[model samples]
Target: MSKNRYSVGLIIVIVGIILLLGKLGVFGFVWGLFWPVFVLAPGLLLHFLYFNRVLPSAVLIPGGILVTCSILFFLCTIFGWSLMAYIWPGFIFAIAVGLYEFYTFDKYSPRGTLMAAVVLAILSGILFGVTILFTVGIYLIALVLIGVGAYIIFGKRRSW
Candidate 1:
């Protein structure tokens, strides 16, 4: 995949899927975000570490923190220590990375778009969570997903 491959149509499909899942509920949103962080993060980090020699420390640090917190949150939830797990903080970390890449778009080399996707995914999860509080959350999430998708497809700006 070239960095220049701007698949607006593919992005629309992804956004549509996200919105549809959002309509499902909080569980859906949580699951949607989990796959990216759990799967993508590791692969991306490994690629950078092995191919770029950029060192795994940067990605692994945050990755470890997020994973640890998530596990603890799950444990707490299972043990009845908390009403529900608040995983937004992990999303916040991902957003921070997104901001870094967004600001230094040129310096990020090949992975800039992927970093932005990380941010969008995290935001989508949070939106899904918030929507859970109200019955309309799903509709709101769908709208947000559509808006972001449009921005990504047409804006041409590095930051999504």
Candidate 2:
């Protein structure tokens, strides 16, 4: 019983069960609902590998991006593809998430990696803000700006 043999056996069993369930019409109402899981599974596998020390920490970046993209895809499938217009910044955010994960898990934190994450985060915020301003209206933007400004100016003055 080698590991590869066990893994192959498990996968075959799982597929057989799924096929049997499908034939039984158990997934009739949810036939297409979990399509994103296929995309997400690899990302999860990458994370699992990193956690288990099977893969280098650098893999977290692409893994995070894949996971985030899968969630965005799922959201679009459920809500509407039109939502992508406003949520496109999520792609940038995903990259930022990957960078942050790498920084967190890597033994030697490079300055450039952290800086890249910060830049990506800022870009994502700007894109999201522009999308909101255009789609929601200027009034909400004004309110948000005022609130953010207030927080920046006064938030640190308060002692927790």
Candidate 3:
């Protein structure tokens, strides 16, 4: 067989296999769950370019924000959209991450930028804590009570 014909035959086989897999829903399942990778890719590329000196540090701002938001989106996609209620604070943190990255990578970085990042991070943490507690506090309280009762019944007493 001619090399051109042989290569064409291989290409036809690969295409057939790909189509078969597509019909089986493999591609559908992957694309449905991992679509955030599309958002994450540019963020990662920007960071890579900055570190390699191919781009200015300003690019890190969007890079950091995209990376953070993509992670939040990926978490929601994998765990369920309902989890977004508890992690909504992550949006604020994403901007903070972007600002912080800029402050870190830029030689003329301003202290106010760092301050803003810190404040946003702290606010995000507080909001996340509040949301988690409100969402699941009852379960935690129940577990604590159960543990205390169990310890009283079965654990050894310590010196008072």
Give model 3's TM-score versus the native structure: 0.84
Candidate 2 per-residue lDDT, tens place, 51-86, comes to 999999989999999999999999988887899998
Q: Which stretches of candidate 3 lie over 4 Å from their true place?
A: 144-160
Model with the higher TM-score, candidate 1 or 2: 2
Per-residue lDDT of candidate 3, residues 1-160 (tens digit): 6999999999999999999999999999999899999999999999999999999998998999999999998999999999898999999999999999999989898769999999999999999999989999999999999999999999997889
Error of 1 at 132 (Å): 4.5
> What local lDDT score does residue 125 receive in model 1, on the 0 to 100 scale?
72
Model 2 earns a TM-score of: 0.68
lDDT of 3 at 80: 96
Candidate 2 Cα outliers beyond 4 Å, as residue runs: 1-31, 138-160
The TM-scores, one per candidate, come to 0.26, 0.68, 0.84
Clashes of each: 1, 0, 0
lDDT (0 to 1) per candidate: 0.55, 0.91, 0.95
Residue pairs whose backbone atoms clash in candidate 3: none
Q: Candidate 1: deviation at residue 120, Å?
A: 1.9
The window of 10 residues in a row where model 2 has the poorest summed lDDT is 28-37
